[model samples]
Target: MTTHNTAEMRICDAIWSIGVMLDYTQKIAGFVTPELLDWRPEFPAGDFAFSLGEQLMHITDIRMWIVSQLGTEKHAYERWAGPYPGIDQPWTFRAGSHSEVMEALESSRQLVQPWIERPMGELSLPTAGTVAAWEKALAAMREKGEDTSQLEAKGAGTLGSALFFLLAHENGHRTVTQTMLRMAGAPVERLA
Candidate 1:
């Protein structure tokens, strides 16, 4: 019997959780028919919305960012585009067919594998870019005089937290995508 180091176990758990979330996302995405891929909720003009395919693409985009930003690969860092501005800003991502979106997710996993397989000192360091983005995201909530202390604490700032953030972020969008699929008459189960 082997005894496990707590830090190692925590890191393993974090990686495992990310993997499980990715698998669940893939399974749910599998149910998205081509017909439902472009469907989005009927929001008012100027309101924010994402088509089903865009949602999947968005998930892959953030995952790629995390790996590129925090990973050990010099090439990935060199090729990394700057951080995304905001949700309201125009997205450069062009949503493709179901197979293409699935391929994107799979490639994101491959890109992240080598980074996560090795331990890095930066894993525990605060992720300044992500923290700044969180502050921007919380601006509206703060304006409403709402208590956002808890959320601020949970914001992703470390490489480890950023990995978990991928799950939380994707899971939130997956709900919207799954709902749109259901409305489009596709059978999207509650896989998560």
Candidate 2:
């Protein structure tokens, strides 16, 4: 009989969490509008300098970061540029239209889905710098008699933690966007 390890279970849980978040985000995106993007809600005034569209881009950026970390290959971090500080800044992208934002989210999911579905054995633990650096770290850890099994456990912990952070970060932005919609006198329950 084939048995699953703790690491494999954690990876599966992470994938499931991300799937739920993606569905939620996709639904929220349907309610967003160019005008809603422009409105700045006053309840929490002078908080964010960027527009709603920019915040959505930031959410995508965070998602891409998680995606890049799932693999060990070079060019794993590559993603389409958005209107943020740089390609890395998913928060500042200028998504002027609802269609554009939806497309961007869809594109991000497409890039991430394969990685999410990949087996835990095929996925690499987070390593520092280049592959050479990672190898050196592994050697050092081994010399210190660090429990490699525990290291796998720690990595499993990371998968769930990363998913939680990603979901929370996206939901924070979604709250702001929904607030803006309410301020614009548009129905907000449709998003929830």
Candidate 3:
């Protein structure tokens, strides 16, 4: 294979690993109780900042947003459309319980899987032109007081940056969700 194809396969392999990580984290997060998902600690203590429910929803949103950028030049965030929660202020997208959140997360996760294997989700978008997509997503993110420049910096305007952001982001949240899971009185190590 050519260098480009090799790189693509490498990226796909890394992303497929991300799928494994997501499954692990989501399984732990599934233990959160409805009340725990809504419960917030008094202070930000290592991943305890947002209610467990909110954080799960946010992860789902990030997955969806990444898919949106690659799927189209027409981002799904312009007016903050429905069906999926828009990354706007307060993140008012509500999930009735952990099940609801996991359902949405799984749905979005499936959507993004194709993105890792295919060329930018096979939407025929420009490569390296992904910088524009990230910029638009960041602008909308800023309106909601989120800053992702650090992530953009890492990617140097390539889609890999976005892919890495999603993988790392989900991996990072695992600990937080597990902590919440334990706090909610679920066993830390789940059994088969």
The lDDT for every candidate, in the order shown, is: 0.68, 0.58, 0.63
Tens digits of per-residue lDDT for model 3 on 1-192?
534444435345644566567667667766766667787555454432667777777778787777766655443332212353334433355435567676776777777776666543422333444656666777887889987878566553445666778888887777777776677667788522
Cα-based TM-score, every candidate: 0.65, 0.58, 0.61
Q: Point out where model 3 deviates above 4 Å.
A: 1-10, 14-16, 43-48, 73-98, 119-156, 190-192
Q: Where is model 1 more than 4 Å wrong at Cα? A: 1-3, 14-16, 44-48, 72-92, 114-157
The alpha-carbon deviation from the true structure for residue 6 of candidate 1, after best TM-score superposition, in angstroms, is 2.0
* Backbone atom clashes (below 3 Å) for every candidate: 1, 6, 0
Clashing pairs in 1: 127-157
On TM-score, the candidate that comes out on top is: 1
Write down the worst ten-residue block by lDDT for model 3.
73-82
Q: How far off is residue 106 in model 3, in Å?
A: 0.9
User: Which regions of candidate 2 deviate over 4 angstroms?
Assistant: 1-17, 42-49, 72-98, 119-158, 190-192
Ranking by lDDT: 1, 3, 2
Q: Is candidate 1 or candidate 2 better by TM-score?
A: 1
Cα error, candidate 2, residue 94 (Å): 5.3
What digit string (tens of lDDT, one per residue) describes model 1 on residues 75-160?
Answer: 33221223465867754445376887777767786776654554545568665565666676689789998888887887756776
What's the true lDDT of residue 176 in model 1?
74
